[model samples]
Target chain A: MSEAVEIPSGTLTVTRPIGVQFSWRKAIPWLLTGPLLLFMLAFYAVPVVAMLLRSVNDPTWTLAHFHALASDTVFFKVFSNTLYTAFTVTIGALLFGYPLALALVRTPRWAPVILIMILLPFWTSVLVRSYAWMVLMGRHGLINEALLALGTIERPFRILNTPLATQIAMIHILLPYMVLPIANALRQIDPSLPRASSGLGATPWGTFRQITLPLSMSGVAAGMLLVFVLALGFYITPAMLGGPREITLSMLIDLQVDQLNWAYAATLSAVLLATTLAIIGVFYRLPGVSNAFRMGAR
Target chain B: MRRFPSSKHFSRRTAMGLIGAGLAAPYVRPSYAQGAWPEQTSIPDILKGSGELRIATFGGTMQETQVKAYFEPFEKISGIKVRYFPGTSAPKVKAMVETGNVEWDVAQLSRGSIMNLQKQGEYFEKIDYSLIDDGVGKEFRFEYGIEMLVWAQVLAYRTDAFKGAVPKGWADFWDTAKFPGDRALLGTTGGGWPELEFALMAAGVPADKIYPIDIDKAFASYDKIKKSVVKWWDTGAIPIQLLTDREVSMTSVWNGRMAALQAAGVPADISWGQGLSKRDAWGIPKGAKNAANAMKFVAYSTMAIPQARVAWGIPYGSVNIKSNEFIPEARQAVLPSAPAIKSQLVNYDYDWWIENREAVIGRFNKWLLG
Candidate 1:
């Protein structure tokens, strides 16, 4: 039955009472996704599934590729190197980026300028940044020339092909990823909680320790995860800036694929994907990350 | 209204099935072949219309040289429009061939690529040798592909490195005490060919005595000089950059790249001595659209004059022996097939690569990690 009702928002309406009524027609808009889903299936899912399958079925079924990956010191060494690089880069970015992010939040007048400076590097091509690092790090590059001119270091030092160079370049490239998320999370604080804590005889350090730090954990965790994951899969920077000992998993995959060793390539890729998932799997189980996930799902 | 639950259950089942299908479709999907390719032997017949031919090539200056020598001439003669996709890789070709939805009408394939994909079976179309000119060598010709060009991985060094005496070959390149500067060399992980040959040669094995390569001695030689080596140049451009920048005074690089760098006044020079010369070929992927037109394109590109023109443009050698007659003698010096250069360069054994490259690269990567 229809009834005239005037209530919320100063509006009047005469409408049927709400009840359970479903129609297949309501879902018709969802059908529009058919082509896109098909496209993803055609271009994405198929190749990924096929590659995963190839890891096992390639050149006759055997876990030999996996065994090689497990037993071989090369694979193990690379795996550990990649993990180490990613972890180091993550920590480096957090230390550098967290302070920058705090400054960005505190000085509202300079926020845009600081943000532009941080994001300017982010917007530039990763390849360009890597090449820039090369110019700065080469044998007679600006750093060495400057050092020579300054009379600080007598010789042009070697830095470009070392793990240190890789770390520096990677941290530079990924700093913004860590900064933006943490800055956004910092911006979300009520500002009252800290004030109220300080008013109740709590010291600034104690207030930050109990309230602000715990609250920002989600962003920190997310930033670390993002930077770590990206660092693990890095190819161009490592290939361009780092030498043999710095070779990562993605580079290994590229090398294997170029050699037309498909099974080996697939295995490496599968392991990378599995490792990424495993890391995320462990991460999601953490209190801060699980909270972030639950919030994201909402 | 009363008949709803059963049909609703049926509808839900249908949706579940549809979602399952949408997800699973591409993985289990059979090849959906397109185009009506009637059998024909004559390449000219394939090109008699205003149809288009698609080619896959690695881009940058390589494609630029190819367009000048191959595409322009073929298009002008055949009245067919040429379309190209750059950075087409072997893995992409493998995916296309395996999926049976081939994209390119023809592809530029490296020796490793051809052997790798061909060994997998029916990945490439069998060539009709009749369409191509007879000038292409029998050794270079294949049932599935036609040799396109020859390039060598050669030794290069900064001209000022040795001052008075030049480093003669890989042996001198390895003798850091004699020449004395930071050096660069690629292990097998860097597409290990010429390096292996160089290693064997440095260990006192002659070029002729190189293959069925004594892996043990080569590695031992590698061990001797590994400490002196500053870096392993992974990409083709790195070696030249290293030499020009004086990061490494001596390094190994592709001959053509060194020529380009020298032309650009990089103050670097190459030695053709004991270079690892290899050939690259072009083939149509299985079930390609306008495949016949692709064959015609490959055929025209392999002709002596076209081959010579491409070689002259890029300084890589033409696969066709008769291309020498077409190329001027000044240009011949840079071409790997030039009598003087050819005498010095050792042809890379692709068959040996097929048999041993995997093990070599594996061991090489392990050695590098160690």
Candidate 2:
């Protein structure tokens, strides 16, 4: 090494070769990513852009479809109902999922068995699951049979075509999606921090509230976003279990498509897409949410 | 280092060129192409070698039995393979026809659906009248399609609910107090529109001058019975299920389905009086890959013997006059297109209904959503 002579005030000497730098290797990674970028552009981006164009243009730059949707009270009611249903289901999933995930993390030996139970419904088709719910909820179905046997009621209640039935089916379907992500996040947290807190005379609940909960906030946020977005787009369960009055945006889209009103369908789809994006944006902006999303990846 | 600017410019130019090509490629490729339909080809030569002639039909036990009865004998006699596809719909038919990669050599379609396809043009091949018998041709003639099966949409009521006070006409059906229980109707506005119109006529609108139907009046009539309707069924099976399960007191069901349900010991009865009978026809798609074989299959399917066999197996009536000769008089009475059943049946205005289907269905859906 050459000794540095201080001639100028703030001059530095470079010794490394330019070829062995970050910029050079960056090109290699980009080349590897090219196929995925192209795939996303072609399949995902193009179709979405096309759908947007279809929604607005529809052979001419007309707001007719949007006007129809906005003017119709049914549209607004359905839209609100979809959001409210999603909110309730997401909260339900989080409440049920967080405890189960904690139990899963605490008991390592029984984890696999419990996980299989959680994942079994996910493996089955949604249609089959909805039909199963139908059998359970129908007038002369299993639930009614049991209730009548217990002398609960003289006549079977109309439970099959109700919003409560829709909620039950949706929560059952979306629970695993929430639990799996949260459990993974909870598992990754360093055990010593909570242990350190407890060792310092912090009570068990106190340590959990101060350290565990804050750390697990990332997972909770992630699970909520996942479950919420999925719930917004659910079509089959609501249609099968819920009454005509419980039709969602997706069911409306189906109605439009079935009626051969493709333009109207496109418009409704765009609305759903916009709503999902807005929710995602809100999720991203929440305190420490972005950091949480990035934490486990690296 | 000195050549960097020139190389950069070259790279930029190449990138711009690639972007331009990528943007323009899809537009450059023509998506719509038209060619001669039913490519004139030898029928026997193409089908002679192929082991199976793939046939597509709506799936169910009835369709399955019909396929077995009709196609199996043909397969044995002609040494052709028979492939069956169930639950095919109009959109699937349109896609297959438009793409010109039709897997179905022959298909069954409702009269309204065939007319809808014909309106699109270039989706179906013109029927070759020469293949049909003259008597059958004169009796069940259509321009673009050959009639296969006929069925009536009639009132199927629970005997337990009616207690011998059965509904005779649309006015009686609308009389909720007299026939009080949950009623069921087909979900589609177009499908059940004619029956509803007939009901309106039975309520007092004259049949001969029932054109330009007052939709508002029709809905007003429907509203009286709407509250009593428990569900609107989308499939044939649903109405049968409704009647058999006693979920609804009464529903309009296909005559054949009602027969099948009755045979299965379901406490349901059908009234052929003032029933709306419709025909399902067979047609070859335009630009069909195997036109000759399709025609041969069409001819084979429409023959009296096969039609009678299909009727015997499925309980649906056939359009063939010869099929009437084959069935016993007792069984013939139940057949919707039989001379006796046909006399009592009201002919649906296929032309008017086909023309107004889109408009009627659109308004109906909006009303339903409301």
Candidate 3:
């Protein structure tokens, strides 16, 4: 059915469908997303809510686990350790990734080869990569043997089972996450802008600083957010390469779960989730990050 | 190039023989192609059942050994089919029991782990003592489970690193001045419980009096040697690797792991002195669908023949005392159960660990960070 409606503008009239056919177009997006939303609600949302509820709901509804965590020195220490490691690894990845991403996007002839080198190791399992790190960084490992042969130092330098090893391996593992996004952003930059700046008598460094760098801020922000969040929850790499004192919050959660301390583990997990959400919230508040997300939505 | 045989050359008699061999293959496929598996132990008719028995085990080469040792033959001897699920842990068992969805009929775990969950709630079935073979030692039998595999946590050291010197116990392990090398110990990072027993022994506490462990004192001892430990290994392989790489001159290693290290001719040796002997038990979850089959399988696997097969396959010791007769003397010399080695190992008290683990682990994390 069709109907004619008079507009507020004097005598203007419009014809419109007045039946079920008119509303169906508006429902298409929902219809497409309905199954996925339900699946996520059932598998992801429900479990997470249940897990959070478990922190206070198990054994007669109490927040003793969280309260205990507040006074627990180990919890504080491990939590701080996790944050510090994540921060350091993120910064390291950004420093290494930006140059690599620039190289990836700038060098047209070698882009595929460079991308392959970055992704080949990324395809390997984290566990296998961590073990490779262990082998390479060990006291008598290849690096040390070469150094010793060169007479760089009389004693083999201890690198494995140290915080340094953990940071190095984590940065290596997380490099691709930081690189791909920045490369995409860099490629999206209008080539004419930098060329125009140069055409206007601007120096190459000046053009890069004012035009190229500022435009790729969104990419840099996105990469940092990704690498930082992933590093925060790292378990295997740290456990394999870190020393005794390098215990992270994830390792602590694992220990509690193994001990059957469900409530306590739930509390620790909730805290980790909260911390991650808070960090992302802060990132979203930043201009560059929000702009990047808005662009991503488009 | 060589020409291949043609199907046209096949005769009627040859075809019939091929069919006969093909039909017999499933039955005659050797379960023990490497050597003779100890003769199959007899089982009661009641123990023979027709159903699937899902067994959960710690995966890897260990599961490979179990397949040859008992899984295949047990399925053949009893009417029950054994299905293996690897990556079994006590925590997983607890979660299954709690969810009322027990995936495994039986799981291989430590007595302490089973008892820890049992103490929390009803998680395990009361093991059928009558179904278990007589060859199993009385000590291995428990109310909720029966120990089928015995292993030890021992002090392993590089024989060449110490200039022909030997580390006898934890005290020597602690003495960096005497041994003069880096060390590694078991850490909780890898799902391993803290090595408090070793810590106490390092503090000069007698092995016999180690029960009801003094946690504060143990940490106090750990403080002294914390800097010396280059690594706090979680997996059994980590210690072996460290020792082989000379990353640590001495480390706490599993007895079973040491056999392979020795076989590889890594100049490393294990000292049984003050080592803690640990056992792995077959625990049936309370609501298992195939509990009957699980009971039967447990009984069959712990018998002399099957137990010997496991010992032959790996360096781990057998709970069935009678299995010793079937194992060669050369092999027995390295087993944790051999009298010479067994006498030196301190019997680990699972009950004590079960009661104190939560508190001790909390303290351990703090102490480790400190």
Candidate 4:
């Protein structure tokens, strides 16, 4: 109360420096993010840094561990195989997810139930879901038995432990990740835009093609990024549903850990992390991806 | 000012000193993980309050049997509270031994797993032979651990798949023309021994002379059936699933899984010929607070009475040879360690695996992808 003084004459007073405003502004974001930043630093960042350092520092400063990962043909194949699976799963997710997302937004009556159905598996453990997939895809499983009894085929179809089964199971697991985002983006689109286009004598297909599809591209990109990045680290589904040829980087990492080659395991993990980061970097560098996020912010 | 040598280090030193008196652990790291030994309460004083025993074991029907046959009795006799953690114990053993904060008093480790960890450092307490009887198999008794039981990696087939000819051995398993259907094989275990041994047997090497495996010939033999093999199962349960589902006509399955399948009325038949049989052991972690009680539990659990109970419940061959009289011969026919089957079954060379594992696994992993 005492500080509230009236200016006696035409004098002006500045109590704080200009930098204080900027500093206080900066502090708001930092304060908001402080817990997350500290958590990431301690749990994720520190362990990752240690793991990367260990790739070179294990057993008296040797690069042999990295060299082993880089030089081995098996590691290379598994690395490439991981990328292939991720790509396949992403495409498959997008193909199924795009229309499901469209239907989810369009169906006024069943949206809640559909959303719950899509999100249901999240509550179930991934291992349990993978096992369920195994039962459904196995030779004596429902599909094969039904087909055989119908006399559609002479022998049981080969589905279990195949690449196709891996892809199918992965798409089932990741469909919600793709669908929810696209549906949210689609819902955010102005309702009048498509109506306005149709009112201007544009055909239904034309209106959708011109107005709705372009607006949903951002959602598509988001869903793709989410599914593809998640798929790269997948192991249980692939291990359960795919053959030896389905060996990927994650499985290779597990094998190394079990082998008691902790140093080598760290090296493989670093390689996998770097590969994921590089993929994300390239994904960001692609045209329209950043634009999609900026557009979605509206 | 400094709280240097940890209590765990002190305990290890006490253990080492006691080794001459037949109280040392099976293995002790020359240097404590945290370094140095600090004076602490004597072992007895440490256990004065906590009579709790924590055992890490796998969950399934077998674990159920263990709870009824071993844990319940041990807790009853020793007046110790027992808690069970269900999972594979190797990785946990590794983590606890490295961090020096051991939670598990006892764990059931596979022969290959125990041997592999032993090579890295001394992790298990040395066995107190005075407490254990000589009835436990010599092959399974380790300096740090005692026999748990034995299981096999055996060739199993669907009876309906072949009407006339049955897959008798590894050679028949290799012949695609005679029994043409999808076949399943295991991918590399930590040691590539099973595949290498079987491949040698398939290539006409006698089971007795299969050791010192010619890696070249084994790979060549593996290459012959590579196209015919449809699934490379990663887990022991997968092959059993494969057989029961009829996904594959023939598969290499764990004897227990096969037994379970057969008992459940699946038309699955397991062949003992050229099969690989392995023993599992019960080991105490080095820094476990209740190591003495854990040892008592292990010794009692491996006795004929307990072993017989386990075999009767789960149908695995008991480690205690004396349990043989208790397990009926009819039931013994299905166990890998049965006297009738033991002569034909090949004992997996655990030492060779311990030394040659990394190199062999590297090659096998490459071949698997190829």
Among these predictions, the greatest lDDT belongs to 3
Each candidate's interface RMSD: 18.6, 19.8, 18.9, 13.8
Clashes of each: 0, 5, 0, 4
Q: Per-residue CA lDDT of candidate 2, range B217-332, in tens? A: 77767767767766565445556655655567788887766655665666778866677777777767667666666676777667676777666655678777777666666666
What's the lDDT for all of these models? 0.75, 0.68, 0.83, 0.74
Better of 2 and 4 by TM-score: 4
TM-score of chain B of each: 0.85, 0.81, 0.89, 0.84
At residue B225, what lDDT does model 2 achieve? 72
Give the C-alpha miss distance for residue B224 in model 4, angstroms: 1.4
TM-score for all models, in order of appearance: 0.85, 0.77, 0.92, 0.86
lDDT of 1 by residue, A1-298 (tens): 4466776876767665544565456657667787888999999999789978878898788898888778878788888999999999999999998889888987999999999999898777665576678789998888999999999999998988888889999999899879877776677677998999999989989998998888878778878887888888876676667864666777677667666678888898899888889988877776666554333211
Segments in model 1 whose C-alpha atoms lie over 4 Å from true places? A1-20, A23-46, A57-65, A197-210, A290-298, B1-50, B187-194
DockQ of each two-chain model: 0.23, 0.09, 0.23, 0.27
Model 3 TM-score (B-chain only): 0.89
Better of 1 and 2 by lDDT: 1
Q: In terms of DockQ, which candidate is stronger, 2 or 4?
A: 4
Model 4's alpha-carbon lDDT is: 0.74
CAPRI quality band, candidate 2 = incorrect
Window of ten residues with lowest summed lDDT in model 3 chain B: B1-10
